[model samples]
Target: MPTQNQSLLDALNACVAACEHCATACLQEDDVKMMVGCIRLDRDCADICALTARFVARDSAHAQHLLKECAEICKACGDECEKHGAHMQHCQECAVACRRCEEACRAGLAA
Candidate 1:
């Protein structure tokens, strides 16, 4: 793949790691009950990101459709993470990664 596509793939991978880490860390927090929504979104976001990476890497016909969906999930996940960012380092990092991935996905779709 080209460097441009490679960068998007890298962003997807980073976001996946961030989401997984955030979900795990949230589970360890004292108020696990309050983190339920965040946990669900984190896992969903990670899965979508991984799928998006695969679609893009293979230049699949569904890539554009998946990118759009991925961007939406990333936005939602970032919003959720930002809500807990003040109290959790993992959330803060995940929020940043989600935003980056969101932007990258949109750019890829536009291109």
Candidate 2:
């Protein structure tokens, strides 16, 4: 089996961690209900990143497809997170992480 590149793995892992953290933070907000959309997207993005990372890490036949979806999801998650970046540091951090991971995922696909 082909080995996964460390850079891509690191980025994907970061995305997963950031997404998870963002979701938890959203849940803790004073108007938690208002953050429902953010939390939902965060959870969804986390699952996508986690699954995509696993697929890429294994260098499976579907890695390319997974990576593509990962990039798209990361972009979406990043955009959504950015909306609340000014009010929430966690959102800002997650946006940064997601953007990085998105770039890495695209690079991994090209590689």
Candidate 3:
């Protein structure tokens, strides 16, 4: 293992990938209308994750602030995904990925 911080970085990367994939999946669903909210949230969460990952990767001074915002976005996306989780496996996966990102963001905030 590269160590815990490295593991977190890896997880954050995974979350970003998950968010992007989920957004694409939402767009592909037969009932586009049903996934409107999910896709919107997925885009937002993915953007946040990408931005936050950049900050963390550079070990930026503003990482704390960015991570805080990332946590908030993740929470909102997670809640939205939870709503459609029963029917959409992608949404459920997104919810899990959002939670993971939230935890990683929070840890970054505390660092």
Best by lDDT: 1
Model 1, 1-111: lDDT tens per residue?
899899999999999999999999999999999999999999999999999999999999999999999999999999999999998999999999999999999999999
Weakest 10 consecutive residues of candidate 2 by summed lDDT: 1-10
lDDT of model 1, residue 72: 98
Model 1 clash count equals 0
- TM-score ranking from best candidate downward: 1, 2, 3
TM-score for all models, in order of appearance: 0.99, 0.93, 0.89
Models ranked on lDDT: 1, 2, 3
- Tens-place lDDT per residue, model 2, 12-111, is 8888899999999999999998888888888888898889878877768998998898899899999999999999999999999999999998988898
Model 3: how large is the Cα RMSD against the reference? 1.8
Task: Show the colliding residue pairs in model 2.
Answer: none
Model 3 regions lying over 4 Å from their true place: none
Q: Against the hidden true structure, what lDDT does model 1 obtain?
A: 0.97
lDDT of each: 0.97, 0.88, 0.82
Error of 1 at 63 (Å): 0.5
Worst 10 residues of 1 by lDDT: 1-10
